[model samples]
Target: MSHPHGDSKRTVWYRTQFSSWMIAVGVVLAIALVVIAAINASYRTVSLVLLIAAAAFLVTGGIKVTVSAHGVTVASALVPFLRRTIPLDRIAHASARWTRPREIGGWGYRWKPGLSAVSLRQGDALWLELVRGTNFVITVDDAQTAADLVNRYLPGPGEGR
Candidate 1:
């Protein structure tokens, strides 16, 4: 969805392509697990665990990035309780750029030193520099629009590359 337009405090956007990819990955992984489990009785438990993990990853991978007057929130599907919110006041810099999964120590939710994000693809991401805590690198389809929306809400020192 481009942006959520309803009676809500914030307008949220979710990448349709990314969501589809995640779903496909989840299904394929689950099928693979089932095949592996059938090969050996001892592998059943491990296969189950792997399937569960893949399901969780798929659920959380469909991210909904909400931009409000106060800040931007990266709401997760599976792990909604651990959603990442970057307050505009706390943001020192905000920008967007082409990013890869390997750059941030793989995909999904990551926390390595001064960077973390719920990444779902290897493309342009919205990067935010906060006054405290590690910087954020999020996967968004319309990175430029998102950054502009945030700037409109709270203009500050930011750049795009």
Candidate 2:
């Protein structure tokens, strides 16, 4: 879809094997909790908690990254309440790079000192260097296309538009 600001929205979803494993584990744990609760009524509360955790795991099973004039937004598909959007104007540069989870401290969402990343797996990622010095990275396929779109949205040297 196109944004009112004259920019088209581009979105990509990345689902890792780890996420599938996590969802499976969560489902199994929730089922086990239910069985335990059936044996003893006192475990019902714990079972409810497990169910919630499982739902969270399912909801956040994949990462959705969008690039538009509004900026680059990284968020969970089912849960959009918690998201990070870096305005195009604030980005100094954007590029596609190969990165690893260890470099960013581990998977999921990570933040360490000058770098923040949604490090889903060890592969191509969109690297954004913001104007303030910190960098944001997102592990997604076709990182080059996303980087190019972000660069296109960025204002040029003397063109205020």
Candidate 3:
């Protein structure tokens, strides 16, 4: 099937496991447990709840990554609710980098010290550094494919470096 936003000449979509919504649910549950435990003055319960919260964060972080495509447009996906779009011309550079959990720091459409780290595991990414200095990154299942798309559409200076 063709994605609505993809170019006519190319149509292929790639979807990968970003993260389990269960982890978010788990955080909510753990927070509730902590509140309940605190109200009931149960130290053991509170401790257990905190542990669960940590586990949820870790598990969720591990699962979360990116979904990308080359010829296909990725307008509608798991994180579409929080996704942003940047024109190819505005992209400065894109590459795959190993980002640790604390590297990006925090979740959901964020930019920390390193770069715009999509909340996904280590994978190929298409990064767009805007001419205005701001940058955006999107995770993709295939690095070479994403790069090819950037080259085809954008085709600016310092490409294929």
Candidate 4:
């Protein structure tokens, strides 16, 4: 949704991504472990481990990135409790760029000294340069539009983008 109110434009944009391959692999491994457990009770412990792995995959399978009046929020599409929000006022600049998982650390949620990213794939991403000089990135489709919405919320002139 997009609308202009007074001097500022209001926009609420969101994108979601699901790693089906990860889920599929997790399920297959879990089933294999279940079969092994059925064959030998001693393998029940191993089966439990596989089950946990499957649960992890399911939990991290999907993510939704939202740009709203409040700020930018990244949450698990399946479990919203697993989320992070970056306040709009803290953002100095926003831009769209292509990035790979390795460039900002592996997929899913990642945090390093001056960088944090919720990179799901190697493609378009919205990059945010925070006021503190740290950077945040999230891989999503239509990143240009998302970045544009974020830029609107940034502080007035001289902030530089």
| Cα lDDT tens digits for candidate 3, 16-96 | 445445456656767766667667775756667577565545353332222233222333243344334554455655555
Residue range 1-161, candidate 4, lDDT tens digits: 45535544456888888878766776787788788888989888878777877766666668898898788998988889989999987888899999999999987678999999887778999999998999999988999988988877776788653
* lDDT per residue as tens, model 1, 36-64: 99998899999988998777667766777
TM-scores vs. true structure, each candidate:
0.71, 0.74, 0.50, 0.82
Minimal lDDT window, size 10, model 3: 63-72
- Deviating ranges (above 4 Å) for candidate 1: 1-21, 34-41, 77-82, 155-161
Give me the runs in candidate 3 sitting further than 4 Å from their true place: 1-13, 21-79, 106-108, 156-161
At residue 124, what lDDT does model 3 achieve? 54
lDDT of each: 0.73, 0.76, 0.49, 0.83
- Runs of candidate 2 with Cα error greater than 4 angstroms are 1-18, 37-56
Q: Between 2 and 4, whose lDDT is larger?
A: 4
lDDT of 2 by residue, 91-129 (tens): 988999899889877877778999998876789889999
What's the best-to-worst order under lDDT?
A: 4, 2, 1, 3
